[model samples]
Target chain A: MPDLNQAGLTITPGTWLYRLPWIGLGIGLAGMAGSAVLAQGHLQEFLHAWLVAFLFFLSIALGGLFFVLVLFATKAGWGVSIRRLAENAMATLPIFALLFLPIAWGAGQLFSWWEGPGEDALLALKEPYLNAGFFLARAAAYFIVWSAIALWFASRSARQDDSGQHSITRRLQAASGPCLILYAFTVTFASIDWIMALDPHWYSTMFGVYFFSGCLVGIFAFLVLVMGILQEAGYVGQVIHKGHYHNLGMLLYAFMVFWAYIAFSQYFLIWYANIPEETIWYLHRMHGTWSNLSLILAVGHFGVPFFFLMSRVIKEKPRLLMAGAAWMLLMHLADIYWLVMPNVYAHGPHFGILDVAALAAVGGVFMGAFGWALRRRALIPVKDPRLPESLQLDHA
Target chain B: MAFLSPQLPSTEEYGVLGEFDSPRSLYRACSQVRDAGYSRWDAHTPFPIHGLERAMGLRDSRLAWLVLALGLGGAASAMVLQWWISVHAYPLVISGKPFYSWQAFEPETFEIGILGGALGAVFGMMAFNKLPMWYHPLFASKRFQRVTDDGFFISIEAWDPKFDVEGCQKFLREIGATHVEVVLR
Candidate 1:
């Protein structure tokens, strides 16, 4: 018989776990400041790079928030043990709201539509929607809605550990339904307002879904990497086992495929329609080094990992799964880079010092915030109604 | 007539078969037998029992690797065949596009990859389980027929290095098996 009286897996991370985030935050601040000083003459380049980095981190946090919402909305039991990590990840959404200020400030440099209603009929027509004041308002709304949902759910989850009440579970489940709808609408518009507006003249209806797929892949990969580290650190290993990692790997693999599928569908539809305005997006991307990057996205982002994660052994083995997860995180960064950078360099790929600094700056702050959130509570939802089910999960 | 002739096979024992009341008991028996270093043994149950495979010392199936390889091969073949037919064989440029279009080849490749994976999973499972045999010596025992019903059984073959008639029976009973019997060939 399985041991019933085994020690509970609640844990508080050591000082190092807390310290790493501060170190990352320090690096980020120093790096951004250094990059800002370095790019004194060309401030536009810095803005573009910062927007890319900010959106990359935001996508991950948003994805984390989405996972929490969907897990509760679906009444899932499999993720109960791991849900606190997701809640912590979700709590980082407010930081992204703060981080959006730079993007808000840099609107003129990053978006073509932000250049005012000067001559171009299309720009004039899109002005009402793409104006700076309205853009900032929409962004604020998105953040408010997101932060409220994330904090509300996370607090209830934390409270459950102390109280162990079934009503909390019922409340979360009831709230999640409308929260998911809100997420879909907000994410859809946020993608439209933020990313798609960069190439103002071009549009694809599926862009929101495309971005959504990447968000899931990014967050799932981040979860796996973080969970692996926590396990290796000898905390929560008893509660979160190979089965959890396997399930996570399966999710990562699934979203990887979904991203590919959505990406391909968008490409195919655009290519098939062949309208000059629509095709211009693909045309810009399919030329020069961008085309090569596109191919790499196909093979590296989808094909290699698809086969690698197919085996039960790889997902069951933490090191192997960690490697896959890390690679995916890099691929996700590359994916964001590919989406955002092409507007500036329209001709070819450009890997500059600013890009690295921007990533480090944004990633460090994001990590620090996420770490702060994670340290605020128990690592596992100890009193969750489904905690036993999650703890007993096996891949059989 | 002699009970057995030199040319004729002897009506000797195959091995001992034991019946357990529950999957847990059968699982315990499997573990005990596996720990005792009996290699040629198997547990049969009406439904799959979690951890029984581990208790029986079974390793993961290679079917996933086989399916992945087959799936990759299928996708590659699909892409190559489409490329050859479109670019090399026919060279028909339908829409003023490039003759070798990888984007256009994606759907076919994906479909064929899924096809290959499904085929591999089905056939590999069948091959691993050694299915569709017309008969087995175990079918000769009337009680063993209940393995398809509610019965849980462990059959240790005579070919096992540790096999002995009386000792095996005692071992099975000690491991919580309710009934024990011998089979003949």
Candidate 2:
């Protein structure tokens, strides 16, 4: 058994993570500057790349928010030890408001509907909801709702570490149900505004769920990777055991399947209906080299990971599960790229240095904020009532 | 003539029965028995004790493999059946699409796969546990009846190579069994 003392639950001095915030910020600024320089001639490509990176990291943060809220709502105990990591991840939501500025600035170039739908009757009919002013307004509202809930839960949980109050947990539990309803609405609209709006003429009610499933897949993969890294650095100690990894792996596997289910559902309906307006969106993706990427997404995102993560032995072993997590993260990026990039490059897949640069810019700031949040508090919610249960978690 | 009836042990004794006072005692005794390399034995309790399977050194069941095999087989057969019907046997182009529209067949394929996996899990579990067992020699012991409520037991069958009635009963008693007896046919 691990020592459950305060010292064991904290980051030791001189650890590499202490430098993460500054280093991550440095890389972030450099990547942003690089993207700026590259955008001189290829402004459209830059915006599209930035949008992909933005959505990728944003999904992870949203996933963190969902995780914390669901844990509180369900009164889950097994996740108590890992809750703080998720808390720190969600606390980075406010920074995404800052990161979203570039997407906002380049919205005209990124979204074709930004300049008013011309000669397209369908887009004209959908004008009020798809207008630029309302889009920005809605974006601001989403940021406000997400940031408020994220900060409230994160701050309360952090405060509970000092006060060690059970009332705080009960209050959070009470608030989680309402917060989740708000989350579902905002997340659905936000996905519609940010991603599905890229092709204004075509729409799928399932798009929100599809994107939400990806968020879950992204966050679970991120959590697995973070847990593995923290354990490797000797930070979280032995409090997190094989059972926790197994559980995280199970969640990751579940959401990965969910993503496929939603993706396939969206496609199956569109394929069966065969309406011109609906099928046009898929036609762009199914043509030329994009088809290969689509096939790869179907197989890589679902098929390979399905069998790879099925075995209990794989999930229990840190290295194997971490490997699976890393691969899934890559596939998640591919999924977002598939969503946004197909709009920009209608002919085929074009992966460039801008994509990497944009990822670094958005991803670096995300990591920097996450590190800052991590260092500010206990790595685990030390005073949570359920910590003991979480620490003693074992699967039969 | 006797093939249709439940078979009774031809020998006078069935095996040794040890009554543990609680699940804790049974768990520890199970570990000892497992360490001592007894193969044909099982523990009975009114409710599950967590990690008791680990204490008894039980390996994971092979049911998952069965489920996967049957699930894939079901999906494959469903797809093949659709292909044969649409592309070869009838070749009716129903929605202005090609004769072989794999897209339309996927939902049924997925559902059938789940059905296969569900059936596999249920039947596989039963098969592994040797279910539909109407008779067990341990049921002959009056104390064993308490297994549905309060009793905890460790029964080692006589067919085990290491079983010696007296030695087994002494071992059980040493391991904190409240009562040890030789169950009969």
Candidate 3:
């Protein structure tokens, strides 16, 4: 049984975690100031780098949203203890609307279709949907929908901690299915608009699923790391055990394979068709050091982790599983970078200071929001009806 | 007797069987049995009880290793076959591409790997469990039929090194078995 007492549930004051929000916000401000100084002659580069950082963090949060929604939709009993952490991650979505300002402001430079489709015939044909007004409007719609769902579910779950109401669980479960549908459409178009539109003439129908798979990989990695960190900090006590970590590791492995499948499928179809428009995208990526990064993603992201996480013993070991998770999180960042950076550095891969600054900027703010959400409630949903079930979860 | 035929049962003592009213009692008894250093014993329940394997002191199965070996072997063989046929045997230039196009070979490789892993899992499990046996001495007991219904039972085969007909029966009873019986082979 779990230590259900208040001592294990809440963050103790003056711990590093209690001050995470302030520290994160401070780093975010400094990062933003550094980015401003770095952007003088390289506004286009800064914007592209910022977009990569934004999408990388945003995918993790979106993965968090999907995780929370699925848990409620299935009324999964074993995941209830960890659901609160995902809720905290999802609750950070509203801040991404603010983080999106750079991309929105630099629309003219980052996206080719932003400036009235210019003289390109194919782009002009896509102008109806790719026009600036509609694009911004769609981004707004996505944020509004995402923010609303994130806030509603997160706030209600937090409220359940106070009210101890089972009705809230029922209501969320009933609403989860529709919310997921909204999530699917919004996430799909959002990826198409932001990442795929970077190479406006090139498109793959599998692009959205590819992005979604990466999001799952990101969230599972993030959860494993966060769960490890929180436990090491003396919170959650014995509430979360090896069983939960094993499950998280399994998910991390499963989604890594899923991401590889979708990514390879997209490449396979384009390579097979041999159409110039479709193959051009792969041609650019396959030519330079970008190809090296692509190869690294295939091996690092899927091949190595495949064999590492296959054993039940490794998954049951927290430190080993966390190591795999951290490596996966890095690969996930590289994946987003691969998708966005090839357009900017057509010659090869470029690692620059602005890239790190942009990540620090966006990531610091994301952590700030996540930490703020974390500090606001119990680390786990203390009053959840299935909390006992999650606490008692053990693998046979 | 025919060569390699199934062994015939003898009219000698085969095992001692114990019946418990519930999973909890059976679980506790299993731990005692395990701690008492008795091997060649197994617990039976109508449905799976979590952690019972731990109580029975079972080690992890070796089936995963079998699946992994067969799966990799299958995929590698598939790739080699495709390369041989496309590059060496016929050398047909389909779609104007290279002779050894690994991209085209991937789908078949993956499918065959899954087939191999699946076959390994099924057959490996059967091999480990020793399935398709026509009969067991325990089946002669009328109460043992309840094993598929509401019964929780623990059976200690007479062949166990420490087994003694009267001693094992008393041990089961002391460990909370409601009913204990000795079965004939």
Candidate 4:
């Protein structure tokens, strides 16, 4: 590890991360495009699968944005060393806005409301809000607002690292409070417009919080995985220790529980209320093969990780933490699958080759973009006021 | 009246108690004592000192395993209780659900599991450490009374195999212990 040098202690990662091989990314894109071409008659299924994969990556980016906002809002110190990772993750927002093109183009095939409400008076009553014009407008608004905030914070952070100005930190703190509130409102509407509107009739007030919880857990898992990779490559372990891993692990664990709590609360309320409108959503998910998927979700998403990450030693151990992180990433995919697929299949679970193709394609592009952003900046917020604290942080 | 009472015998020396001014010094002394293979010894501090536990050569408490076992047992019991009561004793369908619904039992099972874990943590900590005793040999030493204050003390028991009284006292002094006294049982 290099000592603090003339350029205000800039710490750059190896060129490998920046000059990452693109063959895999190219294969991913080709596979995804090929899937859509091969499934010509099954464009509906392709779109549905694409939505799931799209939302999966989008959630990670959104989650990263939220993390950047929260660290600033709370004036957090111990997270500064790793904040660069989050900023890089969040910088993918503009790419997601571009990725939204496919979904927007195929809106007619994907969303039932886009086709105009049938005899269902409920949808008709909600027609104004669910209309294609308003829906697209809302989506655009979400992207613009999110991209602006993410770029603002990331660029500010980058500048601060160079200038070492204290007021920039104060400026970020002041802006975070209002930005967070706007973020909440935007995500709430976005969740409704994108996923909840798929079924048209099914709705839950807790959907926004539930989705946000999942996003947070997904981001934490992504962070853990990235950190593990960096350490394995002999990049960051000198500054980060088991204590940092412990904090990261606890965050992942906490968000997992939060997701469960919101999920269970939604289920319990819908079940207890016995309302036909709400119960219909659960009924669709709970019967037949979907029932088994739901059961696996409850146990795998919450139970297994709950017990696995409970131990302090496991939380601190990099290999074990990586295992949990990989599991969480997979579980997040399963969760998104369960959320999106049940609508198209109606009868039971139906996973296709296209699903895998879409996941890989979108995942490759996302990773490529992430790598580009990561390369453009220092691996750590070198000149942050709290970088010293983050460097010396001890979990105990 | 005082002259007429029988005099008690002098208190026997238990071991040397070394007092340090700060946690760092106490931690250093504990490391030296641990390196010297003095097993029957413990460190006392006004507050928990990080790394001191490692310096004292103490293993992690087994309370976590105890709590986990009890928690799982409680969850099982809760599930069984719900199944028996709902399915066998007085079966009734509510909200069109089955007589024995696993989903319905989750909330109660979770609650009981936490209860079991909480109870296990409290009792297990006490049982593992042999705590809550009204009397101990350390209490016989008048100087030990300041343990709950700013004092940092490390006591090497006489029962230790390598507990040479003068050597231990001199070792404590060399390691920067402010005072060394022979504690009485």
Measured against the native two-chain assembly using Cα atoms, what DockQ does each of the candidate structures obtain, in the order listed?
0.31, 0.71, 0.71, 0.26
lDDT of 3 by residue, A1-396 (tens): 345778767877899898999989988998899999999999999999999999999999999999999999999999999999999999999999999999999989898778786789999899999999999999999999999999999999999989889999999999999999999999999999999999999999999999999999999999999999988898886789988998888999999999988988898888788999999998888877888998999999989999999998999988999999999999999999999988889988897999989999999999999999999899998889889999988886
Clashes of each: 0, 0, 0, 0
Candidate 4 lDDT score relative to the true structure: 0.86
TM-score of each: 0.90, 0.96, 0.97, 0.91
Candidate 4 lDDT, tens digit per residue, A355-388? 8888877787788878777767777877788888
Give the whole-model CA lDDT for all candidates, comma-separated: 0.86, 0.91, 0.92, 0.86
Q: Which residue runs of candidate 1 sit more than 4 Å off their true CA positions?
A: A1-14, A115-117, A124-128, B1-14, B137-149
Q: Encode model 2's per-residue lDDT on B83-117: one tens digit a residue.
A: 99999898996889889899999998998899899
The residue pairs that clash in candidate 4, if any, are: none
Better of 1 and 3 by TM-score: 3
lDDT (Cα, 0-100) at A79 in candidate 3: 96
Winner on TM-score between 1 and 4 is 4
The DockQ-based CAPRI class assigned to model 1 is: acceptable
Task: Write down the worst ten-residue block by lDDT for model 2 chain A.
Answer: A1-10
Q: State residue B152's C-alpha deviation in candidate 4, in Å.
A: 2.2
Q: Model 3: what is its DockQ?
A: 0.71
Candidate number with the higher DockQ (1 or 2)? 2
Residue A239 deviation, candidate 2, in Å? Answer: 0.7
TM-score of 1: 0.90
